[model samples]
Target: MKQVLSLWIGWRFYMARQSNRFISFISFASTAGIALGVAVLIIALSAMNGFERELEQRLLGVVPHGELTGVNEPIHQWQNIAQDASLIDGIVAAAPFVRISGLIQKPGGFQGLSVVGIQPDLEAKVSSIAQFMPKQSWQALAQGDKNNIVLGKGLADSLGLAIGDTLSLYTPSMGATKAQRIGAAKSHRFIVAGIFEIGGEMDLGTAYVPMDYAADILGLGDGVSGVRIKVDDVFAAPRLIRDLGYSQQQYMYLSDWTRTQGHLYQDIQLVRAVMYLVLALVIAVACFNIVSTLVMAVRDKQSEIAILLTMGMAKATVMGIFVVQGALNGILGCLIGGALGVLVALNLSSIASSIEQMLSVQLLSADVYFIDFLPSQLVLQDVALVISLALCMSLLSTIYPAWKASRVHPAMALAGR
Candidate 1:
């Protein structure tokens, strides 16, 4: 019965009349601040989640999870190594590849690129390039024509190239003498059979040709540059490759996706972590308003508190009243903010597009960034964490003011009244 009375009194104080307008307004502001802070945090974290997802699915999708390379020369026994790798526990698929970095020249421009040679049929098992490339283009690549090559969309765009255009490739080869070294540069002509856009930096810097053609150009003589391996779990590629004992053998080395693009992923996580701490501070600042609100409430209700104490109400009950009143504000803010954040997160992509259209600006440029648009992916765990943290902060803010209210002396409070 005492608890019920305390709760009723708390509710009544929260909805107090206009004469306590200052306290009520402060409470409302506190609620609004918490709501805004929580909403922003959720939206920001969700955007980070979206970016991480796209990086894994789009960019890493085309890049091999791991590669087994020869230290001294090309892997001539790649077929047998690939077969052996397939039998490993974590490895899902393997494909042979020849990669050579050189300059590609066209009519008006030249660009440096890594030209990769892949067996058309075996390529599908290792990567999803076909899904991003035109069906007819991949078919052209499978024709075993050594004179044809595929260009990345960015590379093609920069060179103003289209299908059927011929480009010259220059590769520097080893020579015994200094004069021979300068003169030993080999140049090959290839027709552009296809152009592919993987929607990121890969499109601007990589190309593909038939393995036999690449072998002939490099004088590899049936040897492949390396074997690309796809594992059941992408992140575990390094550990799995190491366990296979290939790296310890002579003339062999291991490389995984982490070596090249891991830094970008680490950057994403760092930003996400920093933002979480910053937004948490924002929430703490907002919760400070709850302290101010309750402080003013305790001051204004001093006479009432004195009368209650004189009527034999316990000090703990007095504390509970103020705690409940302050907690109500936090609960309300959390509910409103959580709902709004989820709604915004769910439609973030469409909202970003609309904003871009209205402003006539590209927020994320395909040429400059990995992805061309804003993306958001709402995670329930993130949402729950934000709400819980906000509530805890708000609840803690009530402690000092509630304790102050509990210590109200009947004689002193009534004397002031």
Candidate 2:
């Protein structure tokens, strides 16, 4: 019965429409502060989540998860090594590959490129190159057509290359004879088969050709530069590469995505941690408004508190009343903020696109940023955590005011009224 009475009093105090204007204003401010804090926190965290997803899907999707390479030369038995690696636990796919630094030239332009060689059919299992490439282009490569090659969109743009345009790929090396020193570079002709856009530095630096062509150019007689491995768990690639025993082999070496792309993931995590800390402070500051609101409420309701105590109200009940009242404010703020945050977070990408179109400005430039567009992904866990933190802070803020109200002497409070 006492619990029910305390709840009723708390509700009444919270719903009192005739309260002092200043007190009511402070209460409203408290609620609004909490709402703003929670909304901002949710939006920020959602953006971080979106960035991580983009990194995984767009960038990592094309890069090899792991690699097994020979120490001194090409892996001559790559086909057998690939077969062996694919049977290991956690490894989903393995494909032989060759990578070399080469220069690509058109009529009036030239650029350095990381030339990659892939078997189209086997490469499909290990990377998303096929998805970004046109159907006919990949099909041509799969059918053992050696005159074709694929270039990244940025690289193609730089060289003004298009499908069916012939380009020259050259690698500089020491000539075997003194007479050959004048032109100690080997050149190969290839038609541009396709252009792919992954929206990062890779698009500006990488090119692909058929594995057989690469073997001929690199002077590998039935050998590959390495075996690329794709695994079920991306984060475990480094450990999995070690488990494959490549590290123990005197003639082999192990490499994973961590070597090349781990810094991006680490930077994202660091930014996330800093944002969480800063936004949590925002919520904490907002909770201070609850303290202000409760303090004013206690002052205005002193006479009522005195009368209740005279009527045998327990001190604990007096404290419960304010706690309930302050908590209601926190709850209402969380609900409003959570709903708005979730709606915004889910559609942030579209919103950003609209803004960019209207303003005629690029928010995320591919050259400057890892991704080309803003992204967001609403996470229920983040929303719940924000609300829980706000509630805890709100409850704590009410304590001092509630205790002051409980300590009010009936004689003094009533006499002042």
Candidate 3:
């Protein structure tokens, strides 16, 4: 009955009009502050989560986990090397690749590209490039009947080339003399067989051709540039590549996607860590407002507290009333903020895309980043954690003020009144 009385009185006090307008205003400001802090924190964390997801799916999927390239000479025994590496545990599959640094000739002039030579069936075992393009486009490289090339969507857009378009390729000269090499780079022609879109910056620089054509153009017969490998764990790829390289006869350069794309992952984590710290401090500052609100309430209601104490109400019950009053503010703020945060997080990507379209702006540039546009992924766990933390902080803030209210002396308070 005493607990019920405390709860009833506390709720009445919370809902009742305060004589001091400033106290009511301060209490309202505290709720707003907590709500703002929580909503921003949830949105920021969700964006970071979305970026991590894209890193794994969009970028890492197309990039081989590990690679082993020849240092002094082209890999002549790539098939044997691939078979040996595949036999090892933790290794999923391996494919031979030929990398060519060249420029595609367009009407606008020459555009640079890092061309990859691949066998479609073998390439499928190591990377997911086939999934993003048509089956016919992916199979064109296997035909090996003509000089056909697959271009990235970004490259195609810039060069104004499409499928069936004949584009000229220029590579570094393999001439015997320096003057001959300086005079002109080697030039070749290819028909654009397909264009694959991954919506990444790599689209600007990456291209593909038949493995035979890649070696033939460079005048390296029956030799490949390197071996690409898929592994059980991407993080464990560097070590796996190194171990595989050690078993090879010639000097090899071992590398992984982490070397090329790890910066995106690290940047996401760094931003998330910094935002988490800043938002935590922001919530703490907002909680301080709750302290101030309760302190003023305790001072304002001292006379009422004294009357309650004198009326045979326990000091503990007096404390409970103030605690309940202050907790109501926190509960309301958390509920409002949590709901808003979840709603926004659920459709953040679409919302951002809409805003971008409306403003004629791009949040993430496709030419500079792996995936363009803002992304958001809300985890229920994150929302739960944020709400729980805010509530606990709010509950703690009520302690001192509640204790002060309980410590009110009936004689002293009545004397003041």
Candidate 4:
């Protein structure tokens, strides 16, 4: 206990008085570097996390948590299938649907789009599309109005469509004489009943129509393409789908939102890892200064070390003193950096927006990116990992210097001084 106390006192004196101006300046620079590196890393990673969350929400808004579809035949008696599936413990809502690839043409232009045919009343119970529509109620589409259609905002923009604008759709239908592509290659008018925006790829490529109209166009007689299922917990979808007896061999396939958007999530994780490694190099450079500063301090304090050795101080105790001094610098730097990192991460969004406005350049573009706003989600685990890594590096920085200081012999240090 006395030895530890003495070592603490020695560290305090070295930091407070014996340290020269240049060493003091280097210490300040190292601390500032660690703080800046940590702060920037936290802010960047939090923003990436935010964007990832936004993508997930938007993706789930359009993609059903899971879908059970027939492979060999159009789903007959789908309402029964839906009813049976909904009775499963984790199932929230299940609705039959028909999906078709079609072309939408206006007088101004033409665009290709995926058309979803749904029972509008049940759609809101299963998906967020109803909630995201800007005009016309989901009930409007449910009324079985053959002429009505709902367009996604990006699809509307691409084809120059608006609410109440007349658009034409071209689709293939089975014929009595032969399997033939039917429906008007020319314009068959449809009224754009609503517009929706969810900031996802779906918004750029999809539209919704009533099931009856889709059946008429596609010649599907009371048959649906699939049943979309919403679950109480999205993460449990795969197991739930399997438990519900949906499989490839039954001429049925199941798809989940996670499968549909997993690529984006993986890409985000890869980019985050690469960015962190690049920024960590900054902290590594800062830690190099800790090594140099401690080495010079050891050289300058040789006379003091010799006197302590002559006074019967163990070599281990001498090593511990400088180790404690070096560790104090690291701990102080980490504390300051960790605190600053948290503050910056919490406010990164507003700060980034302000900077973008001041510069008159958009950093996040809605047209090119899934989301427009900067997002920050500071995870406790990420912060803890960063702090741990920085602390380890700081301790490692003291190793060689502390070892060299311990090697100083009483005779040589005394003779040299």
Clashing residue pairs found in predicted model 4: 71-251
> Among all windows of ten consecutive residues in candidate 2, which has the lowest summed lDDT?
173-182
User: TM-scores of the models, in the given order?
Assistant: 0.91, 0.91, 0.94, 0.82
Superposition-based RMSD of candidate 1 using all C-alpha atoms, in angstroms: 2.6
Q: Per-residue alpha-carbon lDDT of model 1 for 240-355, expressed as tens digits?
A: 77765453444677888899888879988999999999989998998999999999999999999999999999998999899889998999999989999999999999999999
Per-residue lDDT, model 1, residue 88, is 84
* Candidate 1 lDDT: 0.86
**lDDT (tens digit, per residue) of candidate 3 on 38-94:** 888899889999998878877888988999999988999998898889778889999
Cα-based lDDT at residue 381, candidate 3: 89
lDDT of each: 0.86, 0.84, 0.87, 0.76
lDDT comparison, 2 vs 4, better candidate: 2
Per-model RMSD to reference: 2.6, 2.8, 1.9, 3.7
Better of 3 and 4 by TM-score: 3
| Clash count for each candidate, listed in order shown | 0, 0, 0, 1
Q: Which of the two candidates, 1 or 3, achieves a greater TM-score against the reference? A: 3
**TM-score result, candidate 3:** 0.94
